[model samples]
Target: MTTKSITIKSDRTIKSIMPPTKGEILCKVSGHPKLFLRVNASGAKLWLYRYTHPVMKSKHKLSLGSYPAVTLAHATAMRLEYEQLLQQGIDPKAHREQQIKDEHKSLASTFEKVAWHHFEQLKNKQKATTLKRKHGRYELLCSYLGDTPIGDIEPLQMLEVLRDIQANSLKDDGTPTDKADRCAVIASDIFNHAIVHGYATNDPARIVKPMLDSYRYGNRPSITTPSEFGQLMRDVETLKGTVHDSVFHSIKLLSLLFIRNGDLRRLRWSDVNLDMAQIDLQPMKGHGASKLRMVKDMIVPLSRQAVEILKAQQAITGHTDYVFHSDTATKNNIINENAANDALKSLGYQGTHCAHGFRASARTMLRHKLKYDKDVIEMALGHITRDPNGTAYDRWEFVEERSQMMQEWSDYIDNLKTGKTDNVIKMPRMRQNDIKTV
Candidate 1:
């Protein structure tokens, strides 16, 4: 092929080589024998590197980029590198293609991309609240490490990001924070997912997790003694004004049933059955807040006093969907989770007792004061109790025993409030019978 030998040394000289008036033209560089500048009739300029394969001796042209975008010096540098590859028995064209494929793969397996994939996989498995929190955590992680390739993230880099989160968490309270540790847990899960999917070779987050400040799970405040609990019950009953009707009934039920605060607040009219004297529903821990949700329903037998409180609550919020409907809430009809806690705080039970404390109180009192069995109380508390043979307790396994225990518990509460311990019922311990498997 015939070509024009162009003495292109600088941008000015390269720019001076204008498009051909008739068709595209290939102007050969004077010094660089393998490099040529191709100019088209449409005024488009391109740099091309022509080389011969080492084994086959076949000639091929590779693009070095455009004229203005890729300067003459850059083009010469790329030509030299390509010639070195050819000398090493490597085809420059194939090597360039492989590099491009690797670049695309790196972009696709970034931490942000892999984390989003993992988050999407949990959409159906998690509840709305859980999904929302996870999405927030993902966004936080992306803000720091999004552009980084998953496999490229090192343990030290992951630790730095976690420390930043922990540091930011202290801005409000100035106290030691567990945010970093929590974020580390999330990152570990994401890294583990990436490893399983082949996006990453190792979990740097897992390696860095042990380096972070250890987080401890603290239980909510509760009163376990009989006299103190009875005084708290009296205070709740006698407390007047400013409390919403829903909050009042909620506290009463929370004390009597000793179920989770979330379960009590989210109670619906459909879940409660006054005729059956039972509240047959799933606990809230298994729904959104918990990592592992209990699939089976929790059956809460209603005592005479609990049934009385429900009948009273029914007359007030019967029209609304929730049993404890919040009048001030705009987003949901249910009462705020803190409403009862705030009310108890007002009644001088700030750190001494909380809405959730009633569960611990009932568990303790039933076991010590009322002389009830551990499994029966645990079942009533919505806990997972197992038999001696390692079998999980069925939903209705201790229903009968729990029913009697609940009635006695309510009566015991009444006796405590009225200072009538002598009136407490002395009943024989109910024997476990008709054991069934789930």
Candidate 2:
């Protein structure tokens, strides 16, 4: 006989048996949905369930996992939920697991993860410092909006963040404050990354514009000219007792060779061909050991001055593969990230120039002053070739051509500093051949 409510004596022990016998089949529970109580034949205390399946015609047995683990209130709610599912003809177990899976799917697509995924895609395509800066942006996003799920960063919240940045950051024209228009571009990219990877439905940043009613005041500064750039290099040469001298020289070499500073500073001696004045750029940054890390190698030809600098550095440094190094205790180790900038400041030319300002200088000098082919400059810089049809073309960085370029460059710097620079040289069309005497 089955009854909904019954109680075992407080002193008596109860047991559930595979086959019932009169002496052993006692009142199984203490009749309270709030508390489940039973005892097995070995006198083990157990919890029992007395409920009907919401979706099945037959009553099935399920262990409520384990005792103490399945607390009374939790068990009661679970039982009631199953009963409701049964009433609705839904499989409660399958449905619950599916619900958990769905919840996980929602949480997996956070803004931080998606933005990082975008950064990961572009990591190798960019320079090392560029990668570091992008990673920095990701860190900022994590700090400010990381906890907010990807789908939840509405346009208004993004707008607020942009406005706040403008309010506190320094402004041009001596204004009290201004929003970071450049940072707004960064935010747009983060949202774009989310959209590209399906982490977000739309780029919220794209929806908002950083204009004071259509007067788009983007604040990217104009770069220094190659002539002005020459003086900076002279200053770098004259810079005394600065820790950054080594980094500054390396940065100068990068501008002359037109290479990424990250790639240039991280070079090893084994990659250089002093005999041929060439550098067999590895398929990745730092070559040998770091290629396995998925960085692509690029070959760059060393200029005459570049080779001279290396030889000078080697005279003092002794036998080592690193072309650029520091006075740190670690053997075979190079300078840290801040070494170049520190050197720049110590040389008394801070704020007026940058290690990367060389890129702007080179791009302009090659394009206007020397009037070399754009593709040639790009190739020299180890930038991605514009020739879409070209296979991984390994052009031996034409040493003779670069040698002429280097001599003229060095001479131009000397002339600029001595106040003998020609007025006509500033004209955009001035060619390399036109300046016969340096």
Best by TM-score: 1
Model 1 C-alpha lDDT versus the unseen true structure: 0.82
For all candidates, what are the clash counts?
A: 0, 14
Task: Give the residue spans of candidate 1 off by over 4 A.
Answer: 1-31, 37-48, 51-73, 84-136, 154-181, 188-216, 238-241, 266-271, 284-298, 319-322, 325-338, 342-352, 384-401, 415-438
Best-fitting candidate, measured by lDDT? 1
lDDT of 1 at 181: 75
What number of backbone clashes does candidate 1 have, counting pairs of residues 3 or more apart or in separate chains? 0
lDDT per residue as tens, model 1, 232-329:
77888875456877789889888889988888888899999999899987876632223242435689999999999999899989998999887777
TM-score of each: 0.66, 0.52
Q: Report the error of model 1 at residue 266, Å.
A: 4.5
Give lDDT tens digits, candidate 2, residues 1-438: 222234543432222233222222223434344234443344444455555555465655445544446554555567677667766887666677798786776577677776677678886677576677667656765666776777778988877766665565644654434235555566678777776666678766667654422223332222457456656666766654554556656755755665555566677778887777777775334232223322255555565677787676667544755777666724337776566666666766576655655655666666686666665555555544433444333455444554555556555555656655553233222123221110
Alpha carbon deviation, residue 116, candidate 2 (Å): 12
Looking at candidate 1, what is the lDDT of residue 382? 75
The lDDT values for all models are: 0.82, 0.57
